[model samples]
Target: MAENLPAGWSINGNGAEKSWFRRFEFPEYARLRRFLDGLAELAEATGVHPDNIGFGKDYANVSLTVPSSEEEQARLGDFVSRLDRLFEEN
Candidate 1:
């Protein structure tokens, strides 16, 4: 499942406890805030939310559950790609 992760993402745990994680960094607080806002909107739009989200003044740590099925893995990949795009845009 780790192989399915997008660039800059890592896998944690194993089996049912497996998850994908990424840390996004921003040059400033305002950009970080904007990225977080975009993340919230993405979750709302996709009906998929991160299992854990931690943030500071210039960074956010996001963790998302890794589903076992291929279909779900594809969905997760798309979500992750969008997250990467959000980071780039912000």
Candidate 2:
């Protein structure tokens, strides 16, 4: 299941059923802020919230969960794909 996640994301074995985690690094706080803001907007628009989102001066972490249903899995995949795109854009 972890094999198919986006480039930098990985499954969190310590988490409940369907959890994925990813951390990103930025050159500065401004860039990190932009990434986090965009990610928050994306999550809100999709009606899915990551379980955790941590940000520092130069890095950020996000954890996402989707229940084990087919529809939820599809939604998760789409969400991650959009996330990856957003990462590239910013």
Candidate 3:
């Protein structure tokens, strides 16, 4: 999972579910929340959304998934590039 992360991001194992991982932490929680909300909406509009999106912590954890593997890879590329910019701003 860490290898699949965008540049400048890293992941660690959490005590709970094996899927639990942390990415870039934002200085402003509200801004990050807003960003996550918009990202979710975008995914919905695209018709291929993530399976899970857990927030409230300093970081946003998004589990990307799609019924089709090809579409998932394409969306992942776009999502990764967008996420890298947020990390860059911090």
Please give the range of 10 consecutive residues that has the lowest summed lDDT in model 2.
10-19
Report how far off residue 17 is in candidate 2 (Å): 4.0
- Write one digit per residue (lDDT tens) for candidate 3, span 1-90: 233555553434443332313355667887787677666666666654655767765777765442235566566667656655645553
Q: lDDT: which candidate is best? A: 1
Give the Cα RMSD of candidate 1. Answer: 1.2
lDDT of 3 at 50: 55
Q: Which has the higher lDDT value, candidate number 1 or candidate number 2? A: 1
Candidate 2 wrong stretches, greater than 4 Å: 1-3
Error of 2 at 47 (Å): 0.4
The local lDDT score (0 to 100) that residue 10 gets in candidate 1 is 91
lDDT of 2 by residue, 1-90 (tens): 444776888877543555788888887788888888898899889987888888879988888875667788788888888888887888
Q: What is the lDDT of candidate 3?
A: 0.56
Error of 3 at 82 (Å): 2.9
